[model samples]
Target: MSRIVERVRRVRFTWTHLAALVIALLVAAPLYWMAVSSFKGKDEIGANPPTVFADHPTWDNYREAFADNNFGTYLLNSVLVSVIATILVLSLSSFAGYALARLPLRGKAPIMVALLMISLFPTIALAAPLFLLMRDVGWLNSYQGLIIVYTALNVPFAVWILRNFFLGIPKEMEEVAWVDGASPVRTVLTVILPQARPGMFTAAIFTFTACWTEFLIALTLNTADRYRTMPVGLALFGSQFTVPYGTIFAAATVSVLPIALLVLVFRRAVVSGLTAGAVKG
Candidate 1:
């Protein structure tokens, strides 16, 4: 019986590993194809057979991508908007979350539910109203406009996540801060926030990712080339009659670099934050 159980366990482990490998390949295949396509020339990219491997890999695609479009400008815009949006969302959400978690407030549950419901509505639904509002406020084609929209879009999730995470933290810490004559603001900044790093990290990462990849809002808000983010700028690679596959692939590969770097740098923090939040709350 013992031998049989051990054999079954080994078999299960083998199957699990195989399943994981297959899933990883599926997830990675599109990215792998994009990277490979970026290295290929236009002719090779548009080959009849759709070659998996480039026959003659060249740097022309990347060169043409930069030469054809304002790639640098787009990249800078995306970085700025994403960073600012992330900061604002995190700051505002943290304050809201702390209040909801610690303060004596009426209708907190209903407020949270309402926020969640609002977030559930599709972005497309809000696009028209938002565009009108931004235009009226003379915020069109502005970094601040995009940042404000992104922050508003992401805050609900941040509040929900951070609020629960805050609740998991011991209230005794805040009590100690109060006993030390710390005001609510001072207690939040010094005592509570330090302990809530994981939640904040998680919220920041989510907000940044959302803002970085957001295309529709950016496109609608910013008609000017200077204000366009990577997603919108990428759309300009293809012409009216024909698509530039090589340039598109190359541009996409470049656009992914910042997000890839972010993941590499913050993987540990993200994992820890997610795990802590999940377990604690």
Candidate 2:
């Protein structure tokens, strides 16, 4: 009877693995095709139907993407915006989250409700006002402008996520530190912040991804080729008359690789953050 039960469990596990594999393939197929097409010639890419592998793979597309388009500049812009925005979100949100979780401020409940409410509001609705504000501050077509907007947009969500994680931490640990004569700020930095590393990483990853893929605001604000980010740059890659699919795919692959690497490197942290939040609640 035990052997039969074990066999049934093994069979169930095998089926689960098989299902996951199929799902993964379904999701990855388009990305794989884009990568394959990036290496293929224009003629081969547009050939009847589509070939799985390039018959004559070439690095020409990547080279052309680099040379023709200011890909380097756009990549630099993306890196700058994403890094700055992530840093600002992490710093501000962590502080705000810590306060919301630990501090006994008046009207805290209402304030948190307001933040959550504002977070749910459509970003598109705020775009026009944000654009006008940027213009007034002479921040349009500037990296600083995009970074500020992205950071502000991302902070509310970050604060909510981090606050929940902070609330899960045992108060005993902080109290012990305080009893030992550590100041509140010292206790937070030395005790709580380190403990909340996983949540912080999760917030940073989400913020960076949001900024990296942001299009509407980036396009609307920075019309100049010099100030354009990767998304905007990719949008302008192909004209109506002529489309360079290979170059576009190559650029996209380049853009996605960094995000992929970031996920791969910090996947453990992201999982921990998610599971910790779930367990806390």
Q: What digit string (tens of lDDT, one per residue) describes model 2 on residues 174-233?
A: 999999999988988899999999999888888899899999889888988999999999
Clashing pairs in 2: none
Residue 46 error, candidate 1, Å = 2.2
lDDT of 1 by residue, 1-281 (tens): 99999999999999999999999899789999999999998788778989989889998888877877788789889999999889889889989998988899999989989989977879998889999999999999999999999989999999987888888889899899899999999998999889888788878888888898999899899999989999999988777898888888999998887777877788887787787667754
TM-score of each: 0.92, 0.94
Model 2: CA > 4 A from native:
1-8
Which ranges in model 1 have alpha carbons more than 4 Å from their true place? 1-8, 279-281
- For model 1 the TM-score comes to 0.92
> What's the distance in Å from true for residue 234, model 1?
0.7
RMSD (Cα, Å) for all candidates, in order, is 1.9, 1.7
In terms of lDDT, which candidate is strongest? 2
Cα lDDT, model 1, residue 264: 79
